[model samples]
Target: MLDQKFATLPKLILQIVQMLQNQSPSDSLNEIIRLVARKFVGLGVLEVADELEIQEAILRLEKEIIDLEATINSASDIKLAYAHNSKLEASGKIVFTGQGAYMCQVSAGGDVLAEKKDSIFRGGRLIVTGNAVLNELGSPMATPTMVEFVFGRRILVNRVYPGVSFRVGRQLFKVQEGLQDVRVAVDEQGILRVDYLYKEHLQ
Candidate 1:
């Protein structure tokens, strides 16, 4: 017996292929994102306690089509630092309390960070001068979230939505599938890599 969840994926792919043949990549991306958002339900992109949360996230994702390579700048509501490493002392830290953060952008610098649960950074972008550690980004739903750094080279996150884009210097990484607890960084070779780091340093 075929599983009900995967039933529409093949059809979706066929539609995408046809769209590609008839339209430019940019022209078809919006539709493709929409189809993916609708089809990805129960596909296990996130591990949440309630089904409602998943639906809410998906609904939010459907609002914005992800742009993988476009330069992103989120309208910010919070500013933690100015990227000079002077505002925060070595012992300083940044914290996001209950409900994490939603619908607004956060800009920070350096390595001091921690967040509570229910974090879904949708509809905004994050600008950090250094490393950015986030509990969640984007959503299983498919909205694209951007994290930009002019001087930093790393971003660590526990949960990733499919369209989360990271820009570190000239390197760019766009997550096309859901991921958990990974590191995104530019290596010594100046190449960007997404992988797991068993131990992390927090300041």
Candidate 2:
């Protein structure tokens, strides 16, 4: 029954071919010829639609790959550093409290030596140095063992004293002394900076 329905396809194609030979080149004629060719080759319109969808999907995948590569390259260009055998020293005014606690903020002064990006400095130690005074009223003993330097929420140095250096990571420092008012001030334009001197490993 289906064969009988399509038995006139050949006759129909012949009519279209004859019509095209007599007609001038036009969009409608071209469309009719394309449809007839597809039908004769047993290629349905649904198959052509599926092929177009597949091509579009491939294009989208290629675009996504390009975007991903760009993101990875951007991430690689970002600068990051870890604590190594480096020393950060700073001198600033220390505000001493009556309870023997001291607070100070030291700016990097744009001369932050640790800002240098060297491959050898990765995963190295970090030592911090600065002027510290022990409050004699708080500890009753002027010893390095009575002083403590707190970095942010962590205890950086439990035992320290004036002119003694300690190790610290990337964090702010708050000194705890006996009851001494140790003040180190800088010029109005001068920034209380930390000088980071890398270890000899980088040499």
Candidate 3:
């Protein structure tokens, strides 16, 4: 009976508790301690005295596991935030547009505009065009003269008529008669700066 109880106790605590179902409650604690001492020969009779300490250690380990899981979740959230910031930093395109604003298609230097499909401008000589126009009595009077932008150097166009212009550094030079504005160089630091041209009409 002692060997059987010791074997059952080593298998599972639930098995030991089931085995004690037939025993009186008053003798169950002593029987459990004997079985535990027999299973762990080095612990001897001290198993009964150390039961509360063992339970405390188990509780501590469970709390530590829960804390470790929470820490892992926090690290995952930080990684996700970093990834989102990286995506935002990599994106180099106009996100918002007003009533009379336009973001033109981007192409590589010396590439044909007809082949350009992606609108996100990155660097090098980029062709920017306006799609906003003013109509007078069902007739298109004039399109947007200048395109105010924010990137790299401060570029300002005085009178931007229908023409293709090239921007080198902070200077804007007319190139051809078309609907494209070209940016010559890319910013080195990747820090975005504003370049705006405001024209006020006085009556």
lDDT of 3: 0.31
Which runs of model 2 end up more than 4 angstroms from their true locations?
1-49, 75-203
Model 2, 131-200: lDDT tens per residue?
Answer: 3332221122322222223232111122222322233333232233321223322324432322222211
Candidate 1 lDDT trough over 10 residues, lowest sum: 81-90
lDDT of 3 at 78: 10
Assess every candidate by TM-score. Answer: 0.47, 0.20, 0.20
The TM-score that candidate 2 achieves is 0.20
Q: Write the per-residue lDDT of candidate 3 for residues 66-171, one digit (tens) a residue.
A: 5444543441111110111122211122221222112233321111111112222221223332211111100012332222233343332222233334443364
Best by lDDT: 1
Candidate 1 is scored at a TM of 0.47
Model 1, range 67-153, lDDT digits (tens) per residue?
A: 321212222233331222122222223455445545455566444244555544654577666676777777666676777765435
lDDT of each: 0.56, 0.31, 0.31
Better of 1 and 3 by lDDT: 1
CA lDDT, candidate 3, residue 39: 38
The backbone clash count of each candidate, in order, is: 0, 8, 0
TM-score-best of 1 and 2: 1
